[model samples]
Target: MQQSEVTESNDQAALDAEALQQEIAAAGAEEREAVFRAAVRAQAADVLDHTTIDDDSNFLEQGITSLKALELTRNLMSLTDVEIPLVAIIEHPTPRDLAAYINEAYAAERG
Candidate 1:
């Protein structure tokens, strides 16, 4: 193959690798979000009904007190091996938002 063709092939390979890495990262993020949601739901179970813990539901409105939020943060930190801030659940205020925050923080910590 010509030098130009070789360079093009290498470039394509690099691009493919980057895409695959992105896909893997995205999958990992989704998994993390799912786990976060489940953990939050479990923690909230003592206060809220099982069905009230949907992704978009307001945790505070569902009867999650500040103490429960702190418990959740600790539980999540233990489960995920990530150092979650005590106010994270309060700051995020919803399962989806909290999951996203946790994912971002976890990624930053990993990097």
Candidate 2:
């Protein structure tokens, strides 16, 4: 992608992130968890071009490089409006774990 394309994507992610934050704020607890999990799963799938993903699937094992991990982190950070380090995803290593980590981090950040 070109520099302009990257900037455009970032701009759109910011706008989408703001809207996601609002939607998340309005959701109930269970709904919020579901939202995060589903978002993580979807983002992972889209990033890796995998059609189906299990919550417990290991991203690294599925061939995720640092670049791919960074992309995933960027998208999740945009969706959740939280700064998730790429290392966190490596440590978490699964969609369920990553989603929980992001949710917890987001909660702490929000509080």
* Worst-scoring 10-residue span by lDDT in model 2: 27-36
lDDT tens digits, residue span 1-93, model 1: 999999998887566546543543566767866766665666566445455577788877877777777777775665556688887877888
Residues 1-111, model 2: lDDT tens digits:
999999998899788788888877887766777778888899999999999778989999877889999999988887888889989988999999987887778778878
Listed in order, each prediction's TM-score against the native is: 0.65, 0.81
Q: How far in Å is the alpha carbon of 26 misplaced in model 1?
A: 11
Q: lDDT of each structure?
A: 0.70, 0.86
Residue 93's C-alpha lDDT in candidate 1? 86
Q: How close is candidate 2 to the true structure, as a TM-score?
A: 0.81
Residue pairs that clash (backbone atoms under 3 angstroms), model 2? none
Q: Please give the range of 10 consecutive residues that has the lowest summed lDDT in model 1.
A: 16-25
Task: Give the clash count for each candidate.
Answer: 0, 0
